[model samples]
Target: MTMDWCPGIREACAHWQNATMLQHTFDALQMALESDSDASIDAVKGLVECICRVIIDQLDDPTSPLKPKDEASITEWVSAAIRVLGRGDVRDRKFADLIKHHNGLAESLRVLRNDAGPFSHGKDGFIQALTIYHRRAAILAADALVTFLYKAYLDSQLDPISSREPWERFAEGNALIDAHVGLVVDDDDSTTLRFILPSGDELPINIEVSRLLYQLDREAYVEALNAARGAQKPAQVREQGEH
Candidate 1:
């Protein structure tokens, strides 16, 4: 059975960059930020439009377990993909929440794309402001879906290989234990553990490792996804300043 799938989802959101991330609209945002380059704004606009147009494209990405299919509505594609990747595995409803929450994010992305498209070519300062806001909004929405894909990838790996197809990349996980003991607990009572491999993958504790770990180790595994890890971790700031 899946051992606390909610932790994986939390890890995916907290440490999203550790996964194979999508730069979706950031490449365009970078161009918009450049003041001197004549090609920057146009490039940004082009990239933003591409993201807008591809909302319903195939979810057959390397990070996705979905097989190639006819282009589907983004919600339809995600629903199918999640169902295949252990829709009933979680007892806590965390995975179900993510599936439901994604539609809102997709709508946000579409709105940003439509609202920002025209301003991308405008020279007026206020237009640039709207363009920047909308484009960034697009990125924020797209980022949620990107993180969910990573979470889904993790979930797919947890399922029995015989039930999954070969093209889904359902194979053995390669996480090697680099440290036998690691722990970090936050104020919210969530724990983080370092199950790093030599290849730099800080994976959550899968079932196999759970068998080998001591009770304390297993508890550490339970908390591993509560917060970010390493330099990607956010710094805590006080009321008026950073700590």
Candidate 2:
């Protein structure tokens, strides 16, 4: 079967991983240090919202038995799905902290503006609070994703205790799902297993043999990854309107 959703998943993950919460925290701190700017507030709010949405979506179980196709928006879908999972009580703490921090900053900004007072100290305090809050939020989000994926994998398998660290297996599963590289072929099936590459092109080959050679030589997989990167760069550049 064609893995049509793999690209979308990869895009979402890439977006999530590209902007570390720490980086945003630093940016917020810098803006606070310079002056309380609208841009800094927006940046902090945006990061919190993005991480929340990502965690909520992953926890909602897209591959669930009751996966709804008619989710109108990520926010709505996450709101609805998170309810079913009963994750709100545990999940709400970090979210509430983020909200509180934002509200406090807004109030401080208002007070400073009204009083004609220097906003640097107040803004700096908000920045410090936001940094701690964002770090906690990021850790929570990552743990939620990893745990949710682990639980789903365990539920699907016959042996629930196959391994203690299911997150590692989950990571392996994701790579397999993306690269379409690994498969467990039955001895009864005489025909060779063929994995369709990501581009919907290229001849299929046995990934086991590829791995064996890769382990022995190390150069092959490096070359392959490099080639894949090389091939993708120009397309990305072109998409960005670069010459």
Cα lDDT tens digits, model 2, 73-125, are: 32333334334445444557886564344334434433333233223234344
Task: Kindly report which residue pairs in candidate 2 clash with one another.
Answer: none
Candidate lDDT (C-alpha), each:
0.42, 0.42
Name model 2 segments beyond 4 Å from true.
1-36, 61-85, 89-220, 223-243
Q: Tell me each candidate's RMSD, in Å, in order.
A: 18.4, 15.7
Tell me the TM-score of each prediction against the true structure. 0.36, 0.29
Q: What shift in Å separates residue 127 of candidate 1 from its native position after superposition?
A: 8.0
